[model samples]
Target: MLTNAVPTTNGPVVGVEQGAVRAFKGVPFAIARRFAKPVAPAAWTEPRHCTDYGAYAPQPGHLDLAIEESCLSLNVWAPAADHPLPVLFFIHGGAFVTGGGADYDGSFLAAHGPAVIVTINYRLGPLGFLQLHRHGFGEANNLAMSDALAGLDWVRANIANFGGDPDAITLSGQSAGASMVIALATLPQARGKFIRALALSAPGRNIMSADHADDVARRVLEELDLAGDAGAITSVPLPTLFAAVERVSRRLADETEAGTLFGPVLDGTVIPHEPREVFADGSLCDIPLWLGSCRDEMAMFLKSMPPAAMIRTTERQVRAAFGEAGWERLLSCYRATARVDEDPYEALLSDAFWHRPMSDLARVHATAGGAVWLSRFDHRPALEPFLSQGPTHGADNACLWAHLPNFIDRPILKRMGGPMTPEDIDVAARFQANVLRFVTAGVPDIAEAWPRFEPAKEPLAIFSQPFHVIPLNDGARFRAWAELTARPGAVA
Candidate 1:
């Protein structure tokens, strides 16, 4: 809903929040769309309307379902500030498969802290981070990383006229986006570009190896009866190429190069290291951290599962993935969270698969002396009924942006709001403010006493309609799980 434009040295700007300031769009910085590569855009004279978003690159098919590739684009929401505003650059996460920047309207987030909020589109799936045994055709990997890096370069070079503080930029992302942050954090060069980062709801272990990339390339070659070189891969249609990758994925086991679709490859180039591996080294030694997960992250994926069905699925999967001790540790967590002795399968999955990874990551942050603020995003009544998606992995974005129901109840949300409780709206506002604050000042304190990660006392600050600080770690439990994982048996 842009009303008018304001011209400047960089470009013409369109008003993002009618009552606030404006932002210009598509001001290119990097020369090529690929890695540290490509031709630069020619200089323009006329100020263009920054109202519209740029084209989103083709995205991979959704594993939960399939969607179109039309949602790629970047959006900025900047408000007038008495001083240069802090900038928040958000990287949208979609499992390296499906997602779009349009899903996040920066206005909701930017307005809260009076910051410049940016949401951008990046390449996805095989086009983003797939590797091959040998170079063939236009074969490449790490397109995802390239997209993010390019976007950052763009922000650094041009966000000035948009009222953004270049020196006060904070890179914020969730899930795959967070993974990108971890990768960038370890990059020797990407340092000094971003002042800080806030990685929300990112799973700790992702990324492939050089051999893994070669294996995937071999699989694609076998599927097409081609050679193991990159030169010939360009001949295949985009759909055919992606489908070939898919065939290997659905049929293979974990880390199996025999198959995989739309996931990042550890090609040892753009992504020099795995997230888990470099995280322990404290590469980004002093970057402030705010890490967390939802109370029912699995409930989102298991939206179709009732409590009982969730129990069955958790038992089956955990038993298969972790084995006996895994099962027991999960059982103990369930017993503690749900006093009725009923198996909270979703909760079990939440702690082991989601919560624990974040906790483990926090320990690394603490060791590095980085200020770490950890939390458990709690939805008082669970997040199943909204958006037909439960408190699924990426669901917390709703609260962070105050979209959907919360937006409806608030006057500022415009058409995005509906009917949400006041509590919902307030909590969302706090979360939004925290995101902006983190982006602007590298701190997420809602009010008095925004505490630090103190595993010795309260290990986490649980965020929800009624938020609180909680002590969730138990030495014995962690040790037991560690033993279970180390046994070479199972960890369910």
Candidate 2:
């Protein structure tokens, strides 16, 4: 299935045609050594066949999967058209420990809009993010983010050959990937590489400080029986290190206040300060921003927790997220806003982790003269028979991408896809068009005058079957959160 060669800045690479799109998979964007910064990929004399996806970074719980250290590869999906088009660079979300670009297929977005779509893979877990400054590997703590920056750098220098506009780049991501996009927008090294960003459910408050990162590193080292030994850490088998990472991660999961298990640290080089601190300082990118979270951001994760424990955790997080004076008011608002009987905990998690931080960041970005467009994805298909939970995290992805729930596996999905309804197709089409419109013009072309978010007029574009705009603070819980967040020293 090899097609004509596309000449890049480094070398000429070849791709294969899949349906209406040309896919270039397993393309190396950078080369790296363990616990070292990435360097440019080696030059090749002949065209490199990039048809199959490369290896993913080694992670625990997936021992059967291939793993490697030099795993900074990316996949490109471009339309068959000859003219240049806009580019959408996506990063996958796996809580910064697992997941890779290969998990996603971007051909739908590529063919539908005739735009080039690039999904990249970065290092994960202990190998990528554990702080090692105390042990002398200070530069490698944020290798995952550095890998993403290298991928963006590759696109900036070489996307033109794939009929993509280098200047019209839109950085888009979900979950952990969304956080990376926000971090890139804040960092100086990644400035000017992207025109705008589309952040889908960014966990804006999970970044760890250097000290916390060091603590996690020490625990992992102790678990692996390599305490205070830099040589063993650098040379240990990945499986042994990954098992230790799992022990540390499982132990920290109970500490809800603890940040992500293995994620970007504010190491003073890559990520200068905490994300909240950066957003508060109004130093974010001044481009147009489109960001939002789902209605049930925690349902997927809370499935394992007992009802009483979940309720207790929600109650505790409420005060930390908001403040002391209005804890009762906030809980009352949450209970009143619960759409279902078992929804209060989901509501609490959504506000504390997703909506509240997103709103805060929107305010700061607007204050910095950036146009902010916010939304809430509340579309739950009637055909979701696998789980009763409504519109959980990453649910909007079904309508946004070609990988609709109907097209996926499971007995329920098969039956649903067997007879796709007009409403389903219509909704999917509308979302894809709006997303492409934003990618092309830097702002979503909706029916109404999509107002930019302000302190008073917190406008939001709600994406439903009938997409429309409403004040972000419309509901009781939202109003209460808006008031609580406006006060000094709110954590969310």
Candidate 3:
């Protein structure tokens, strides 16, 4: 049965109950005005009915959700348990552009895990990531990062009231959200807030240098015809602001690698040092990490590209980044390892952008004496479009949240191929069980079979029909990618 009211730091909130799960949706975690830091919401005595989701952060109009500036809210799903449970704090991925806490329904994970699940909404696009500190917008740099921090603060202070162990929070995220997890793990302010981290399909690089962010900010301002009038930014209508963001992003796409126009900035104040540097130096070795990428991450993005053009473009880029000899060696390795009918270009792009960087991070984290588990989602669903793509980007989400019926038809899963089969459900159950183990015990239950990542053996769990852990055997392929990623201006 649903609780009459759950006390929070700011006030009491009423939630909906379904079977053994209690879900509190659109609970305000923080309040913020445009271009300002988030602050605690006003306290209230009357219980707030957070039965419906709050408006999404002002973003490019796409998802048919209400957009507003006061979007710093979070959702929670907890089992009907008396004792406090471990909390899984998940961040949604939308390439720092689209997505919201409501996009993911945590009821399934919460019920099955018997753990509290928290999903959050943070600012997005120009409204969130535009770094304008150098342009006299002091409170604007890394606003989304700040929003995440604010949410964490709220959780740490009040999650226990909702039947969660505040001290045992596991920070988990995917894609752009995964990058945020990496950033938070490295941030000194975020220490002690979460016990462990899980990152899936984190981009090779999402942090933008302050100078680069400044350039993007200036371009955005120029597009809006408010170049020198930084004060006018706060008053610009959402549509006008987003239109300028789109224009600036299009112009910068060709100028920058991967068209990454906006993301967290190394403002020297919020994020003092680079995340890779922190990971390499062993500073973050104490926290346990579970991270991985899909087998073919780029297939989703390259699906629309004509086969002939895809091959030509991939060849031109590969040859330019890596010499002809390097290209041949890489191609040979991929031809041997890639799935049947998988495009060489798609495989190469996936490796260069997602797989290689994840592997490198795993090796360094493990080398530094950190407890880490690495895995790859290789299970291709027995469905149409996804069968052609073969475990493409965001496919794991389909398995991870398969228990949530409402979630099954969401874009991340539906577009990847939904209406899961019996085989697919079996795989999902196994994946969720392992994830729950990690969230509760700080280590996956498959530890006996899947040993901690070691640089020498490079042990990695392959999540497929017959899930198994195997030491990485493709040194040649990774070596080729390492060289390409090391090249200047390479997106990897």
CA-lDDT, candidates in order: 0.62, 0.76, 0.81
What TM-score goes with each of the models? Answer: 0.81, 0.90, 0.92
Residue-level lDDT for 139 in candidate 3: 89
Estimate, for each residue in 1-492, the C-alpha lDDT of model 1 and write its tens digit.
664665443455554444544644444333333212322354556655556555445544333232223323466677877788888888877666656565666665666678888888776666566664255424366666666776777677767767788888888788778767767666655777788878777753445566766676576678866764455555566677668776776554344422334455566666667665665677765788778777667665565433423334344566777766567766776566573522366666676657777787777777766777887766542233544443556556667766535442321112244455676666776777677677777777853456777446445776675767766655555565666767764433
Off by over 4 Å in 1: 1-17, 23-39, 60-73, 137-139, 253-264, 303-329, 332-343, 380-390, 403-405, 408-417, 446-448, 454-458, 475-492
Q: Which candidate is the best by TM-score?
A: 3
Per-residue error for 478 in candidate 2, Å, reads: 3.0
Q: Order candidates by TM-score, high to low.
A: 3, 2, 1
| lDDT agreement of model 3 with the native | 0.81
Query: Where does model 3 exceed 4 Å of error?
Result: 62-67, 305-321, 336-338, 382-388, 404-407, 411-418, 479-492
Ranking by lDDT, best first? 3, 2, 1
Local lDDT at 437 for model 1: 72
Q: In terms of TM-score, which candidate is stronger, 1 or 2?
A: 2
Q: How do the residues 40-123 of candidate 3 rate in per-residue lDDT, one tens digit apiece?
A: 989999999998878887666643454565688999998878789999999889888888887787888998888999999999
What does candidate 2 score in Cα RMSD to the true structure?
A: 3.4
Report the number of the highest-lDDT candidate: 3
